[model samples]
Target: MQLQKKTRSGSFNILGISIKLSIVILIFFGVVFLLNKVDFPSPKKTIEKIIPNENFKIVK
Candidate 1:
């Protein structure tokens, strides 16, 4: 029946949404974990290393 089809489709939509949400959450946590494990230089340190000159600059 038409009602049965509608209910099944609604459940499928919910399942799809939940799966996508879980995947996004997992990716976010994985990124956070990897960043925590790695040691990166501070923004100031990186800025200090750059030599500002005409070659790297966009305008003359």
Candidate 2:
């Protein structure tokens, strides 16, 4: 008796795409968070400079 080969299908593609998208989203958010945290003049300071109204003060 001969063994039959298993065929691959679209499920693999869907899983691969989902995982890749998740990783890209995670990395993007991580970079954004890091940028907000690392002050070369920080996110808060930049926002304050851009909109220097008393109402727009950093709420933190």
Candidate 3:
């Protein structure tokens, strides 16, 4: 009766919140991936800089 109706509505609200959170997570990861692909270079360069020179020694 009344309890059933409330449960249904609550389920829908929970579903909507889940969808929104998932979208936000996806967008955050997408932006990170795009930035990485673009050679944004912050994290990558920082790691490279921290490593010893032998680690970056030219292969050719």
lDDT of 3 by residue, 20-56 (tens): 9999999999999898788553554543346667767
- Judged by lDDT, which candidate is best? 2
lDDT of each: 0.79, 0.81, 0.75
**Model 3 clashing residue pairs (backbone):** none
| Candidates 1 and 2 compared by lDDT, better number | 2
lDDT of 1 by residue, 1-54 (tens): 355434344345778789999999999999999999999877665344666575
When 1 and 3 are scored with TM-score, the better candidate is 1
Worst 10 residues of 2 by lDDT: 41-50
Off by over 4 Å in 1: 1-12, 41-60
Q: Compared with the true structure, what per-residue lDDT tens digits does model 2 show for residues 1-60?
A: 999987975456778789999999999999999998886943555433465477666767
